[model samples]
Target: MTHPIDSTEFASLLCSRLCHDLLSPVGALNNGLELMADETDPDMRQRCLDLLADSARTSANKLKFFRLAFGSAGGFGDAVPTHEARVAIEGMFAQTGRVKVGWMVGDDMLNKLAVKVLLNLSLIAGDALVRGGQLDVGAEKRPGVTEIVVRAEGPKLVLDPELRAALAGALPPEGLASRTAAAWMVRSLVTGRGGEIVLSAPGEPMLLFGASIPG
Candidate 1:
């Protein structure tokens, strides 16, 4: 069984995860700026400018996604519009040209916790698509339960075993790392609220994630 983590440690893990995700684009932005400053050729300068723009956009997209997924988005509102979650997911993967998303969730709203679970699961699914692929997300609310599913298909899909353990609430708190933090967070949120999470194994051609929570 996974042991409970103190708030400070959990927050640190999340910070590490965010930093790791943003490092690449932010580093590229710095490199682009440096190149633009040194290059005298007009074409090379223009290329640097373009790279900077892409990096800026990527950085912005990641912040937006993380704000909703890991921050206090939706504020005091009890329910967040479904479109907002959809847009957040789309923006998160926008820079990853290798991945495509099929959003099957409807226009109805979702509670804050539900949205959190959805986005975190989507993040894991998208990351599993190592060679770029399609990710489909769907959620439905019926009476006492809410159902969420994320499916990923690509040329080379991998679901890390440690991540699987984290998602299953089998990974000890001490074993948590930046790579598996999101999965751990998702599992904590779902099961904390009397919900259950599931994932497809690594060897499968596609990665599938499912969660059921009390409505």
Candidate 2:
């Protein structure tokens, strides 16, 4: 059985996810302001403006989706709406860093921990496709348990060692912090539900993994 998480751990991981998502936009805004302030070239300024727009769009879209994924859309002591969950996934993928997002999960109202598992698994998959590729999100529910799977298929699949460690539950603080904090949240939520996660190798260049939560 998995142990429960304390408020401190929960708060720390949640804060990390928010900060990580905001950094790109906030950084872009700062850079755009600076560029506009001095050394303004028509072409260069346009590029800066474009960068700002891209960053803002990415940040906004991600936040909108995260509100459902990370928020109480599901498992807030009440059943979550299937359409809302679908909308959450759709909202999250409005823009891709370099890769595309694919949806394959059947619509369902996931419990809170199950939602976190999917969210964390997606976070890991998103990072793996840094060079641009496709991501697949799917889930399955059986009596007494639910399984959420996230797969990243591209020409290449990269798995950070620290991520492997964190998934194994022996994470080092420094290395753990460097990873998307959502990873930890996923871990916490899954384990709290007496569940486990499995990450497979990129055979033929595909990263696939899933988390199972007790029903």
Most accurate candidate by lDDT? 1
For residues 1-215, could you state the per-residue lDDT of candidate 2 as single tens digits?
22345667656777776877778788888888788788567998888888888877767777766776677654447556555655555556525556676776675666666665776677777777767688888887789988788888777678786676567665645444635456666776778768888888435468888888888
In model 1, which range of ten residues has the least summed lDDT?
90-99
* Cα-based lDDT for every prediction: 0.89, 0.69
TM-score of 1: 0.95
User: Please, what is the TM-score per model?
Assistant: 0.95, 0.77
TM-score of 2: 0.77
| lDDT, candidate 1, 114-159, per-residue tens | 9999999999888888888999999998899899999999899888
In candidate 1, stretches whose alpha carbon ends up further than 4 angstroms from where it belongs are none
Task: Looking at model 2, report the run of 10 residues with the lowest lDDT sum.
Answer: 172-181
